[model samples]
Target: MELADRVQSLTPSSTLAITSKAKALKDEGHDVIGLGAGEPDFNTPSYILDAAKEAMDHGQTKYTPSGGLVPLKNAIRGKFERDQNLSYTNSEIIVTTGAKHALYTLFQVLLNRGDEVIVPVPYWVSYPEQIKLAEGQPVYVKASEENSFKITPEQLEDSITSYTKAVIINSPSNPTGVLYTKEELQALGEVALKNNIFIVSDEIYEKLIYGQQSHQSIATISDDLKDITIIINGVSKSHAMTGWRIGYAAGNENIIKAMTNLASHATSNPTSIAQYAAIAAYSHDENEIEQMKLAFEERLNKLYNWITSIPNVSCVKPDGAFYLFPNFKNVVNHSSFDSVDEWVKQLLEEEKVAVVPGSGFGSEDNIRLSYATSLDNLEEAAKRIKRFVEKHSK
Candidate 1:
């Protein structure tokens, strides 16, 4: 059997691959401490679960509008108003199976053959693949560790071309946990506006911020930017509802309509019960989310200090999200290993610790460690990593 050229050319996710390998080792009775999982460690709040139960008991198991249920859309609208001070009508919102699906649909609707989408380095694993699936070229702009793994306005301006259709900005970014400041976003928004290009703002980690850092939507900078920005978000990360499949996109009504129409033939709608549950998630108190965020903050602080204390390992202290991207370039050079990949493999095989290599995120000098686990697990993983580095160092 033959696969499509596009499918054949796609790169499998390194995060998922490392996670699977860790799980396999665990199944084989190895005590593997895996730091590759991206979702929150908390369970979905009971109120949200109760809402789903009520929906099922009240017969909401049937299909909803392809775009989403009106109530859910209204809840999302309310969230935007309360959180970001941005308002969107129901027509501008379309809920999909997940934030990932919302993004894939956006690329499908927005891209034409050979169109370019400017993706920053150390991007979420799925962005480039989704662009390729939509027949769009991914133009990568490298964001150095010195810049907190964020692209400058100059870099953004330089990467634009006639074929550039959109630029993705992921704040509280997945692998790096780097948050772009409001001023930074304003500058980038200006670049996109001047170029007449679209901004795909993936704010799925918006609610997962820590310290004094805040998540700012590029769309909120101005009316002009809002008109051209598509905000991709969901309750998956915020409410520990990763399994709920209730992500949505908010932006231009025409683009939302096109994405909805595409979704109508594809997923039809996000799961009915999950949509109802998400309504409760958005409409209710956020105490649960606050608790989870605090827990993550605590774990992150400890893990950050621990990792940086290790010899020759340095990382930008993450401002938000539950991951720490630590550069091991010095360690790699001092160790017997030739590359970060081999170093990561040996750590997993010998110390029984699993982490995603930075090469997957377009950085070869670092590795991503997700603190979205128990503090105990994180501590143990750190110990194992420290020991491994000590043993291999020349």
Candidate 2:
């Protein structure tokens, strides 16, 4: 049987592909150090797990409201007010299975056939595919490395078109780990307001920042922007609850209601137990979250220095998130490999260090290595990468 055109046109996620390849190699008895993982390696904090247990013991196994439970919504609302200085009513929030699901649902509800969503370069891999799945086009604005992998207001203005419906802003971005400053977001918000388009702010990595860098929600810039912005976030990265699949979106009540309706037919509610766990995640003391951030910061500092110390590799120090995206153009140019993909393949095969090639994230000159694992694993991976670059350097 023939697949739908949408399925045929979709590209498999290269991040998952590389990760699976690494797992296969490990299963074959090779000591593979897989660094492509997007989730934190840490376990869910005990308090959140305890909450799940309590919910289960109370027979909270049935389906909830299609959007989310009232308690979970209240917790999410409180989180936004406390962290972002933004307030939302229960009608304005819809909790989906994950942030990714929230995004997919948003596209399905917000876009019409041939609508365009502006996506910046070095974006999270799923953004473009999710837009396309909604019969929308993804217009990419190249965020050059010199700009710290961020697009400017002028670039945003240039990318908008008659068909443009939304612009995605993934701060503390995946793959690149770059955060947008508050002022930067304000300027971009102006462009969105001027163009009468929506701003889809993916703040899933909001709590993962290091040092003085801060995560700012674009929706908090002003009432106008908030009216047009959809805030996508969850407990996946923040609370190390990737498997729990509790993510939510806050925005116009109409859109949230539509998304909830769509989800009602698709997956019903998010897992009942997971919703209860997320309530605890949002309500509990944040000490565990801070500890996780400190651990990642330490790993990032060591691994960033180690990678930059190598001969032919260069990377911008990430402000947040757990990944290091380092440019390997020099290494690729000097080696027998014709592309970053080939270089990544050979490195995984020979050195047993798995990394997602930058081509998958809309840039072909770099590769992403996550520091979410232990420092020992990062150190070992760095050693292997350093050797690989040295052997291939011109």
Candidate 3:
């Protein structure tokens, strides 16, 4: 049987691949310390779980409006207004299975064949694949590790072509965990506005900042930018609700309506029970979010310190999110490995410590390590990694 060309060209997600491999090793009785898992280690807060149970008990397990329940939309609307000072009507929002699904569907509705989306390198693994799946071209613009793995407005401006349709902005990004500052977003928003390109802001990690850092939504920069920008976010990371799979896009009403219509023919609607649970997530007390953020910040600090202690390994301290992207090229070369990908495989096989190869994220010299696990597990993983470095350097 032949697979479609779109499906054939797609690569397996490195984070999930590494995580599956680690799970396999563990199932085989190895003491694998997997740092590739992207979701928070914490259980979804009890309140949200209770909400789900209550929803099920109340017979709320049927299909919802294709766009989302109005109350859920109101909850989401209140969230944006409270958190980012951005407002959108029910007609301007579409909730999907997850933030990942929202991106996939948005591209399906936004792209024509041969249209281009400017995707910064070291991106979340799915961006390029999703664009290609929609018959759109993904124009990669490298975001240098030196600039904390962020791209500049000049770079974005230089990448635009007549076929360019939209540019992705993933702040507190998946692989890098770096936040774009307000001034930075303003400049980039200006470029997008000037070029008449839409901005797709993926802010799933918006609530997970550390230290003095803050998350900024590019849509909140101005009304014009908001008009052209689509905000992608959900309860997955912020509320430890990854499995619930409730995410949404807020933007132009036309785009939202099109996505809703497309979804009606596709999913019918996001899970009804999950929609009610997500309403509780946005409606009720959010103290659990702060608690998870504090735990992640602590783990990030310790893991970042431990990983950076290795000889020839360096990392930029992330402003938010739970991942540390450390450059190990010098370490790889010094350890006699030909490539970072091979080094990552050997490290997993030999030391049983799993981290994602950055090649999958478009960087051949780095690896992504998630700190969304217990401090005990992280400490052991770091020790094993340090031991691997020393052993290989010998």
Error of 1 at 35 (Å): 0.5
lDDT of 3 by residue, 1-394 (tens): 9988889998888888888999999999999998898899899988889989999999998888998999999999999999998888999999999989899999999999999999998899999999999999999999998888889999999999999999999998989989999999999999999999999999999999999988899998889999999999999999988999999999999999999999999899999999999999998877888888889999988998999998999999999989999999999889788999999999999999999999999999999999988999999999999999999994
Off by over 4 Å in 3: none
TM-score of 3: 0.99
Model 3, residue 384: displacement in angstroms?
Answer: 0.5
Q: Which pairs, if any, clash in model 2? A: 97-245
The 0-to-1 C-alpha lDDT of every candidate, in the order given, reads 0.94, 0.94, 0.93
lDDT for residue 92 in candidate 3, whole number 0-100: 94
lDDT by residue (tens digit), candidate 1, 306-356: 999999999999888889999999999998899999999989999999999
In model 1, the Cα lDDT at residue 299 comes to 96
TM-score of each: 0.99, 0.99, 0.99
Lowest-sum lDDT 10-residue window in model 1: 211-220
For each predicted model, how many residue pairs clash, with residues at least 3 apart or on different chains?
0, 1, 0
